[model samples]
Target: MSSMSARRGSRIGRGMAWAILIAAVLVTVFPFYWMVRTALTPAGDLFADSHALWPHHPTLINFKRVLGMTSAERARAAGGSGAQINFLWYTLNSIIYSAVIAIAQTFFCAMAGYAFARLRFPFRDALFGILVAALMVPPIFTLLPNFTMVKNLGLMNTFFGLVAPSVLMTPFAVFFLRQFFLSIPKEVEEAAVLDGVGRWGAFWRIIVPMSRGPLITIGLTTTVWAWKDYLWPLLVGRGEHTRVLTVALGVFLQQSPNTQPDWTGLMAGSTLSVLPVLVLLIFLGKRLVQSLNFSGIK
Candidate 1:
């Protein structure tokens, strides 16, 4: 019958959807699996078999070298710089950079979003339109001007330099939070005003609490972006005192000349660098999801 054929077609479509989802997951997760496998594999056994799905002789030697546990003579022989590699310092810098940028951007963006959503002022729409327009501007276009400004301000090689250009809310962040703010009921703010709460008090006690989901979402997103950023930090924080994990990894790659890449150490460093973000998502991912659902983003 026609009904039976339609039911069978629906079942086939559902099966195809599930198949696509599984394939997507595998494609995304395979790289991480390969990185971890290579990190654990012994250097001697890495290229012995090129089609390995798992290490034949797993070892922690790569991790040890990355953590600076190898003897100085061995490190030197491996073509590493004689200077002690301090991965811990690089990690700390990365943490500080991401955290500061996230907090600053979240707070400032919330303030701007609320203003754009609720406050009536001259040229308000025009100003917001400008922000929206800025979203279309490529970040690379601003790099030269930002670099020149930083140099003029003598901020190079400082944490301030790393955070300066992006410390405030981004245009996209402002737009996102503004949309969330617009979804809030104006009656809530009016009620707070009737209770003698000033604008600032109402914003802090009511709007902020109601907007917690969007704020947290923005904070997490900004943190991840800052953590992964390479070019800006590479340009501004060139000194050892200010270098972050990504820069340090790049330096590690170039520490020796005319030698085979330190595939094991590189993989080990990469694995360690990704741990913080992975752990963060593991702990906060549920909260982020709940917030997104509550915010009616879909």
Candidate 2:
């Protein structure tokens, strides 16, 4: 009788779990479905079937037109270049900034987090407390001061302006890495120290290799943030020569046709923009989830 009751309860819980999983998947995927559907809709009928969630007659003209515009922008840029938008250069610039910040943040943030998590130091708790306090200050509050500092340093409209600000170890990255570092056993570090390895040496040769889970997590997080960053990149990268993909994308949308905006083209461009992040997530999803599990999410 007890075994029969346990089986009934297990079946009920399993049914509920499956239902919740399907609902979650639908909620998350509904937006992408809409984006693609809109991208395929005829510009003329965009408002006709307002509730339509699927494409009736998919078209390729939008893709051709968007690609053509993207190409023209590149050719014009290869020449002396004037005030017109240059998607290629801007895209290249965004990639460079994002890649650099990903590498820098991973390297520097890991080291800083290790020190904070393990090493003995004067005012360690107090210093970490200050850093935690910094997390409360909204990024908007720092924009003006950062802009002014950039201008004073003659870095306005330059790569330095875009990347230097992002290179700093953010509070979130430090906290993420610190949680993973704390999970590591201290005896391993002590063994390295007793074997004549210096602090930096052990960190480079031992700790880093062992901390791959959190490192990959932080790298992916930073890369995604850098790719989607718009406000700061727009302010510092205003010129056609330096505009990033987000800015270039906005400029393209602003010039769409009135009756039937280029749906296919917008979708193609957007799909391309999202491809990298999606691929990275697919490959690193396990590592990302592991870090989050250890970190205790806010």
Candidate 3:
């Protein structure tokens, strides 16, 4: 009788776990579903009293206007006068900004992390502690200083200004990579040394290859952060020439002349903006999971 009760309790616990997981999935996915649904629904039908879960009248009008494929009259009606900023160009800028930051952060952070893990030098721990401490500092606090530094360097409105401050490395990336590097066995490096492999060669050929998972994780994270960043880019990248997707989306939201926000176009633009990051995660997410599992990062 006791064994049967134990089995029944286990089944109930498993059922509750599955129920919780399904609820969590719904909570997470519903927003994306709503965004896409709104994007598909014609602007006229969106506010109708009898709104359907699926779009009643599916239309590409919102996407067409956002993508600049619609007639000039239609574009003007939907996006207003300030919609002159090209959506595709803004997307391109985001891609460039995110890609450069990701590559630079991954390489530099890996080098810094390896040094902290393996190299001996004066004030090494102290310096690393400072770097780690920076993780606790709110990014908002540094905005003024970074803006001043960028202005002093005469990099405003340039791609360099957008990329320079953040592209090099980040505190979190360094800390994360350092932790991963610490988990590596020193015997591997010693064996490489015994085989006459110099430190640089060993790092490049062995350590980097072995650390691919962590590197990918850092790169993906940096890329996503850079892509979503709006404040810094908006501050420095003032002109359409340097505008990124997030800033452009904000601009789009405000482009409505009469203060009536173009909900349909906004939803369409949002859906488009989210696609690149989603595709990136879909492709690289497995590597991230593998890295976390391999590194015992749970």
Candidate 4:
């Protein structure tokens, strides 16, 4: 009888855990479903069922307007602002901004991290401590100074200006890579040195290949951050040459002269903005998980 009760209790616990997981999944996924639902909905049918699981009249017209395929009159009739937003151009700008930051920051951070982990120099520990401490400082605190510097350099509305602030490295990236580098066996580099390889060669040939997982992890994180960043880009990249998708979405939201905002079009733009990150996460997410699970630094 006691054994039967224990088995029943275990079953109950497992059922509760599954229930909680399903609830969490619903909470996370429902917003995306709602966004897509609203995007698919026609302007007239939007208010007909606020709690709808699907739109009454599903159409691609909202996407057409957002992509500049529809005429201004048609877009207005479909409850969109008649502005011809250059969504493709903005997307390209976002790609460039994100790619530049990710590649440059990852390479520099790996070098810095390798130096901090391997090289012996004066005040090395103190300098690394200072870099780690820098992680405590909020990014917003530095925004004004960075903005001022960029403005002084007259890099506004340029890709260089958009990427300059994050192009080098972040304290967190350096710290993260350093911890991983510390876990690597020094004998590997020693073996390379014995083979007549120099420090730079050992780093490039041995350390880099060994650290590919962590490097890719850092690169993906930087890309996602640069893609979603809005404030700095809004301040520095307001020009047509460099405006990213996030800033363009904001501008599109406000372009409507009507009292009611263009909900469908705005949601469509948001859906487009979310796609690249979503696809990225889908493909590389497993590698990111594996990198984090590596038995280093623990």
Candidate 5:
């Protein structure tokens, strides 16, 4: 009788867990579903059925309109404002902006982390403590100072201005890599030193190879953050040559002919903007998860 009750309780617990998982997935996926559904929907039909699970008359016309493939008349007819978004150019800009920050930050932060973990410099602990404390300060507080410095250097409306503040490293990133570096055994470095390897050689040849997991993970995360960043880009990347996808979206939002915005075009643009990030996550997701787990263990 006791065994029967325990089995029943286990079943109940399993059912509850599945229910929670399903609910969480639905909550997470519903927004993406709605975005795609709205993008496929004719603007005229948007108000006709506000609670639709899918569009009745799905079309790719919105994509054409957003990509500037459709004629202005055709775009207007399809419920677009006909303001052409330089989608390809903006995408390239976003890629460049994100790539620079991710690659540079990862390399530099790893070095800083190695120094904090292994090197014996004066006031090292105090400096590291200050860095860790920086993680607690809101990023907004630093924005004005960063902007002023960039502007004073005549870097406004340039990619350099957009990426300079974050390209080197962030405190949390250094701290995270430092913790992971601390987990690596000192014997590994000692062996490399006994083989005539210097500090730089040991770091590059031994430590870096072993720390590939964390590096990849941090690189992916930093890329995503830079890609999605809007405010900083909007401020500094306002020129046609430097404008990123997020800023382009803001431009699209304001370019409507009428008071009502181009909902279809906006959604289409959003979908296009998100595709690259989705593909990146899909391919690197396993590594990211493994790295995170490894970092956690460390």
Candidate 6:
């Protein structure tokens, strides 16, 4: 009877967990659903609640507008080229920026984490503690200073300005990586050292290969954050020459003199922007979860 009761309880718990997950997914996905719904609706009655759940006359016009494909159509074609946005350029810039940050962030964080975890150095704990304290300070607090520094370096309106401060060495990356490195067994390194491998060599050859899980997690995380970054890019990249996708998307929506938003095109751009992350999450989900668990985030 007790065994049966336990089985029943386990089943109940699993069911409840799934119920909660479904609810959370619905909450998270509903906004995107609504955005697409709005995008599909005809421009004439976009604000009408009666048609809010579903469009009266669903059309691809909005996507066409966002992609500049609708410019030839009577609905939006009359708008001169002067009004069109250079979304493709900004998107490429975003891709380049995020990719660079991910690579640099992963390598730097892993090396720093190895130092903290294995290498004996003076003031290591003190320096790490300082890094931890730095995390508590919100990034927004440093924006003005960052901007000033960028200006002083004459990096404003340049990719270097955006990449230099953020991509190179962030405190959070160090912290997360350090936590992961802690979970690695010291015996492996000791064995490698006994086998005549030097410290740096052991880390490069032995340690890093075993820690692919954690590195990929950190890389994905850094990529996602770098891609989503808007404020920093907006501040440093004023002209179209340096604008990333996020700021360009904002500009796209607000371009109409009447402040009229383009629902379809906006959703299309957003969906496109989100595609890479979604694909990444799908591919990395297992590794990410395992890494997080191994890194001590129970």
- Alpha carbon lDDT of each predicted model: 0.85, 0.74, 0.84, 0.88, 0.87, 0.78
| Clash list (residue pairs), candidate 4 | none
Give per-model TM-scores. Answer: 0.87, 0.77, 0.88, 0.93, 0.90, 0.81
- How well does candidate 2 score on lDDT at residue 100? 93
lDDT winner, 3 or 5: 5
- Candidate 3: the clashing residue pairs are none
Model 1 Cα displacement at 264 (Å)? Answer: 0.4
Q: Model 1, residue 276: displacement in angstroms?
A: 1.8
Mind giving the per-residue lDDT tens digits that candidate 1 earns over 80-131?
Answer: 4544677778889999999999999999988998899998899999999999
Off by over 4 Å in 3: 1-13, 78-82, 257-259, 289-298
By lDDT, the candidates rank as: 4, 5, 1, 3, 6, 2
What digit string (tens of lDDT, one per residue) describes model 4 on residues 1-298? 9999999999999999999999999999999989999999998888895778988779999888888887889988998766677677888899989999999999999999999999888999999999999998998999999999999999888888888878998999999999999989999998887799878889999999998888998898788889989999999998877999999998887787668888888888889888898888799878766766546443
Model 3 alpha-carbon miss at residue 66, Å: 1.2
Q: Which stretches of candidate 1 lie over 4 Å from their true place?
A: 1-17, 76-83, 256-259, 287-298
The segments of candidate 6 whose C-alpha lies over 4 angstroms from its true place after superposition are 1-23, 41-59, 69-82, 289-298
Query: Residue-pair clashes per candidate, as listed?
Result: 0, 1, 0, 0, 0, 2
Candidate 6, position 3, lDDT: 100
Clashes of 5: 0
Clashes of 3: 0
Residue-pair clash count for candidate 4: 0
Q: Per-candidate RMSD vs. true structure?
A: 2.9, 5.2, 2.7, 2.0, 2.4, 3.9
Minimum summed lDDT over a 10-residue window in model 5 is located at 289-298
